[model samples]
Target chain A: MKIVITASGEGLDADMDSRFGRAKNFIIFDTETKEVSALDNSVNLNAAQGAGIQAASNAAETGAEVLISGHCGPKAFRVLKEAGIRVYNTEAKTVRQALDLFLQDKLVESSGSDVEGHW
Target chain B: MTIAFASGKGGTGKTTFSVAFALSADDNVTFLDCDVEEPDSHFFIKPEITGNEKITVPVPVVDSGKCTGCGRCAKVCRFNAITMLGKKPLIFHELCHSCGGCSIACPEKAVSEIQIGTGVISSGIRDHISFYQGLLDIGNTKSPPLIKAVKKKGDGASLVIIDSPPGTSCPMVTALKGADYTVLVTEPAPFALNDLKIAVETVRILGIPFGVVINKSDHPFPQTEEYCRKEAIPVLLKVPEKRAAAEGYSSGESIIKIFPGLGDEIKKAISTIKKEAVR
Candidate 1:
């Protein structure tokens, strides 16, 4: 299973970014092979609006089944759920810690968006 | 001639000047309240509304049967209003700008445009002035379309007066567009002077001729006058601040009626604007 974690940097030691839509980078990790890759999300960072929906589209295009982020907005959550991607809300310190939490099944799956649309 | 009254700061007396000017101007004047978020010209004009129409914008509606989810609509949407998830296009109405790009880009012609109400434009008459105002729906952020709709009603009037929204953003620009002249209202405070400079820059960029109207002129502030002189911008009128005038304004009374000689000053300003507009 592929898992996408919102992060501020590319390395495993980099802190997990709390913002989902405007995160600096998204780290994609494969649970079986443990292969990691980084996708830049700077385009949506300065967007005047609709950053969440654009970020959700980026996540969907990545073919990741799971999303681990500190927060998810309403529009992004709806799009991810429709794409059959399960979203987990987490406050893990680092990207590696968030991956471990997901592997241990300790992360809480969000039933709906934890934040408002624009937040 | 269309005259737009604009200010960079709110509560700087744009509506007050607009209402008073419309009342004092010739009989064939049209007053357009372009401040859709808070249409307050009616408070002073008290127009008897004769017509009201809903202002709408086109939003894409997807037909699932014809949609193959090729992601064409998603690709064409600059606003990110459409996203394809599992062979289905999800439409976010709030983010839609009614550009119709999605429908045009759709290969299967599955995307259809549907109109959604964003506000209402009402037309009426108060004495000799024909009044039109746009009222934006609560929580609706699209205001330029409604402002355009209100301005459309001013075509036949001999003189059009637009009460523009505060700030130098899109709505204010929409109000100032195609205006023959602009009357910038501001106070003599520091913040007002700062914002007035911004407003002046905006009008200058649009290449519209504008003059300053200093409200609350009784307050002793030399900075505003000095700035106007340095910029070579004409000071069309200066309305003195009075407790009785403020009290009358709060109670929806026309300041022209309360202050006897003020009407002549407004008329003189109009003639000056007309002369400047020709130059």
Candidate 2:
């Protein structure tokens, strides 16, 4: 399964970005092969409006089945749910740590959006 | 000729001067309160509203039955108002600017326009003066359309006075555009003087002739006065700060009504504006 993590920098050692929509980069990791790739999200980082919806579309386009971020807004959550993407929230930890928690089934999956639409 | 009262800084007495000037003008004058966000001139004018119309903007509505969600609408939207989620498109109305580009870009003929009210434009009469004002709904960010609706009512009046919203932004430009002349009202302070320079630049760029009216002129800030002299911009009027005037203003009374002698000064200012406008 492909999992996308919101990250502030490249590689698994990068810190997790708290903001899902305005994160500086998105790291896509394959659970089986452990292959990792970085997707630049700077375009939506400074958007005047609708950054969450745009970011959700970008994540969905990657065909990732799951998303791991520090937080997710209502609009982005709705969009991701429509795309059949499961979202999980985590603390301010490194991408590799979040992946380990998810692999151990210790990460809490979000039932509903944890933040407001424009957050 | 249309005269707009503008100020780059908020609470710089744009509405005060506009209401006072409208009241002091002849009976055929028309007052357009273009500050849709907070139309306060209605408090002083007390126009008997005869007509009210809703101001709307077009937003795209998707027909789910025919929509393939090809993502064309989402791709064409510069505002990011549309996004294709799975096989459907979600439209964010707040971010929509009613540009109609998304509707046109929809290949499935599934997009249609629906009008949503952002504000209201009301027209009425105060004595013999025709009064119009636009009131933007709280939380609505689209104000330029409502400002345009207010300005549309000023076409046939012998004299049109527009009370512009404060700031040198798009809303202020919408209010000040196409006016024969503009009267920039500012207080005598460093902050106000700084904003006044920006306002002056805006009008000058628009190629509109404008003069300055220093409200609370007795506050002993000479830098504003010096700036006006250096730029050769006419000082149309200087309304001295008076306790009675401030009290009356808070009670929704005009300056001319509070101090009847100021009527002469307003009259002189009007004449000066007319002469400058013609030149």
My TM-score estimates for the predictions, one after another, are: 0.93, 0.91
What candidate 2 keeps of the native contacts, as a fraction, is 0.79
lDDT of each: 0.91, 0.91
| Model 2 clash number | 0
- Model 1 per-residue lDDT tens digits across residues B165-265: 99999999999999999999999999999999999999999999999999998788899999999999999989888898889898998889877988999
Best-fitting candidate, scored by TM-score: 1
Q: Write the per-residue lDDT of candidate 1 for residues A20-107, one digit (tens) a residue.
A: 9999999999888889999999999888888888899889888999999999999899899988899999989999999999899898
Residue-wise lDDT of candidate 2 within A22-111, one digit each (tens)?
Answer: 999999999888899999999999998888888999999889999999889987887899898999999948999998999899988899
lDDT of candidate model 2 versus the reference: 0.91
Best model per lDDT: 1
| Candidate fnat values, all | 0.75, 0.79
For candidate 2, write residues B41-112 as lDDT tens digits. 988888999999988888999999999878899899998889987678988888898899987988888999
Q: What is the interface RMSD of each candidate, in Å?
A: 1.4, 1.4
Docking class of 1: medium
